[model samples]
Target chain A: MESTANNRVIHVRELVKKFGDFVANDHLNFDVYAGEIFGFLGANGAGKTTAMKILCGLQRPSSGTIEVAGFDVYKQSDQIKKNIGYMSQRFSLYEDLTVKENFQFYGGIYGLSATEIKDRTRQMLESLQMTTSADMILRDIPLGWKQKLAFSVAMVHRPKIVFLDEPTGGVDPITRRQFWEMIYEAASKGVTVFVTTHYMDEAEYCNRISIMVDGRIEALDSPAALKAKYNAATMDEVFIRLARAGVRSMNG
Target chain B: MRIIFYILQKEFRQIFRDKVMLPIIIVIPMIQLFILSYTATFEIKNTRLSIVDQDKSTTSRALISKFSGSSFFTIASYETSYEDGMERIKTGTTDQLLVIGKDTEKKLSRKEEASVLLVTNAINGSAASLMNAYASGIINDFNRFILEDQGPAGAVPALIAVQSRHWYNPKLDYKTFMVPGILVLLVTLIGMFLSGMNIVKEKEKGTIEQINVTPIKKYQFMIGKLLPFWLLALFELMIGLAFARLVFSIPMEGSVVLLLGIASVYLLVVLGLGLLASTVSDTMQQAMFISWFFVVIFILMSGLFTPVESMPAWAQNLNRLNPVAYFIQINRMIMLKGSGFQEVSGLFVALCVYAAAILSIAVKRYKKTA
Candidate 1:
């Protein structure tokens, strides 16, 4: 349980969330270590977003002991916020603002000073090689650039942990590849990355992957180990084997 | 608290960065205050009058002179007959017409009664009634002048004396009543527009999840969200009231600070209702519709346009739930009656209760889908 774990950055135990009578997280338990790309892979409505929401402190668990960055979920949430960055599927950046303005606004909300926002924005824009388009409105930019910019804004405050919910949902394959390169760069700097996606090819990039089905995680292991155990040629086969078996087990 | 300031700074930057919100927040309110204060007045200042003198005699000429000398009526034209005076009224060139009959001198000598005609445009019922009263009173005083010195002791005067005095507003200017009421509407509009769509817009854009993940406490976030609008709403209130004082010449008999203090709570309730509406609506359109619904109801029962006491007893009692009703009472008291805290305490307490209830509903419903 999170109450006992003092080492994990995210410690979720018996994290049950329900909507009316339908359980979204049923006695869920998981822990994420520091500086690892933890992949949360699931089909639609498999509670991946729900579990991520609880970890991020967006939603309260019906009855559970959960902790993020070693702070209790029930209290001391602001401290956790200082250590976290969140980018949801909706691209949590102001579209009307220029790329530079989005960075400044989010940076300011994270308690960065004017100098800090400016300095971080410059370094991040330079790294993205997008210095010339700093003044271009976000809506005018292509989806590929916007996705990358969203990730940079999430990482602006240099939070210890960052959550990306479907961060590369609609980008082209080449852009998605470059997007993972940015994720790798952040991970190499000892920043923990918690990501949710349904992209089977993308799961192999994770240090460890958890495949969830029907409000529960059916399989949690390295992608290679999952493929090997299921005797499958790819992560897609491994996901299908687990998803089908989980559904069968539920009906039986 | 520092974080709240950070959010406010970001919100202001975002507000200014957008093209649509700037005009809605500042420019529109100022324009409304100016136009409403100057135009939406009850005290009739400029009136149009036409005189039809049938006699053209000294007595009729003297009476015509009295009409021209009066401040309320401007001598629009000279009419030779009553039919010509009616033409002036029909053409909309004159608001009112006065007809003096041909036998004015003979009637006074024989001591027989004489008649005068007053025609007013009845479209704007309040202004027309007031103009009619003012014209009749002035004419009656002129008829009494002719009778006091020249007529027989027992002769009946052609006009009746109706000595009247204005109570609160001695000048009876339309601007005096309108200025304070417009101030109430301005504060309500500012409060409703800002808080009404903020949370829902955040949700639609998915920033609610971004904020949710942070250790931002619910009450802390609520205070941060509502306070900017509360202060902004107060700023709007001050602007509207200042315009009322300067442009409309409406005097505040009550303490400004006390009025501001009570008004702040009413702003909170209005803003909280907007936040509560945001919680229920997922889209800007839905939020807008919900906010407008309550706005219409509050304005109808607000007592800014009509007298609350004149409404049915049940309707009057139902008005107690409306924050605008309380605000209207406080505004009129401070701007008109000039009363202090003791006079407005009942409304103040009611607004506080409404604020608490509305804020709680908003906080309880402010949840991201887990």
Candidate 2:
């Protein structure tokens, strides 16, 4: 899709993030349009998390011009934070708290009114078919349910953009598919979704995917286009081909 | 401010929800207060005394009766030989041996100076010194009585008397001294360890990443985190003060309002230390270790168990940085001495400055961005 300034939810340019002498994100550039499911694909240490963290205002870039939800990363990060929701790879909800309490807490911090929080929580629990488990502590629930609940909690405040850092990391395939459906439903409601994952098949669900190799975006295109460009049969083959070639060039 | 309320609500829920932690936070410290107050004492009571009376004179027997009458001593064995009495001390059956030389009455008749020997088990130096002091006091009293009896009753010679009176705690009750200091320690423990561990737990559980990504201000998050424990510490102090009055009968001589006011400022110093520890540590274990290191040093050097003046010069200087030392001093002054704000104002100002400096550094160090 052709993107305009009005439709762009995230704009990153020449973004460079360094840790002392090590460059974790090197001169990156990307733009995410409104309601788009953008996949950030990289190896374990390929700087996708670093870039995502910067976009979410959880970390500052060493030198860059970056904007999230129309707010500058450095100058207006607080504003940016208000307009975005984030779920880390590690579970973030309080395990000792009941499911409903977690919803109230997150929504409350985002300045949602009590009635709004209650209404949203009820609707979310109904849609997730977790109405019966509202009073149950998070630790007692299964991992898949916790992941799904985490995503719903992230959307409790109806953020303009929701950043999911490998939200479906350790779930079964069926649960992962269910999670993607949730993402799709959120996107259909015009919420931009920024996600990072290693699952090649999951990348196919994104509107567009960016592949990072060695702190640099090696490819940015739709999954079909990437497959055609790399002349690979599957996204798995395309990822391996790009990663190996990138490693070879770096070695040489 | 409403956001802070929500954060505080969440923190209180989590704190109260933990089955293991709730009791540990509430009940354990009160139990410690009871145990430590009753057992940790400096007063030497019922010290076992072994006597060897070689002189069977009436004056020597009178001296033996004098020691037996005193409440501080328990006459365990009466041996005829000095070596037998010394054996009682070596065997730990007695704390000290009192040996009276022969011709004790004859020496008095000749107007000669007679000396009684006291040998104490000095293994425990402080206890031994205290035992020696009690024994020497009895001997001196007996000598005075003998002089009075030998001299003309109506024409008694004038002698200078040293009258020593203990102020604040007239009875010299160890509980009275210990309860206030121990109360400071409990409050500091609750403030420092709980606040520090609460934040680092978020880090360990990866929940801090979620909080950091939110729009909550740093000071709001910190206040929310520290306020609950601060209040809890104060509540603990109140409970401790009640126990001091009802159970230990420790006098609350100063104004309760003034004590609480100083306690609130002191809590800021401890809570700020906790926050600083949390900011530097990435796990609950690390935070606990860091807090324990400071707290153990603070409590030991705080003059809770011993007098601060007796410590080495460098240790006394180092205690200037110890928040526990300052609070313990303030607590003792107000609770025991009935000291008002005017008396503790210098220390109070120092605590206020410390609170400001520590809290500012903690807030600055606690970065929302990694």
DockQ of each: 0.41, 0.81
Candidate 2 chain B minimal-lDDT segment of 10 residues? B149-158
Give the per-residue lDDT of model 2 (tens digit) for A105-224.
999888999999999999999999999999999999999999999999888889999999999988999999999999999999999999999899999999999999989999999999
Error of 1 at A17 (Å): 2.7
Write one digit per residue (lDDT tens) for candidate 1, span B125-189. 88899998888878777867877867577774455546788967887776787678778888898
Instruction: Please provide, for model 1 over A70-117, each residue's C-alpha lDDT reduced to its tens digit, 9 standing for 90 to 100.
Output: 888778667878899888888777777788878876776677888998
Top candidate, metric TM-score: 2
Model 1 misplaced regions, further than 4 Å: A1-14, A27-29, A64-67, A70-79, A98-101, A112-119, A132-136, A241-252, B34-151, B155-162, B252-262, B337-370
Classified by CAPRI criteria, candidate 2 counts as: high
Clashes of 2: 0
Model 1 preserves the real interface contacts to a fraction of 0.61
lDDT minimum window of 10 residues, candidate 1 chain A: A243-252
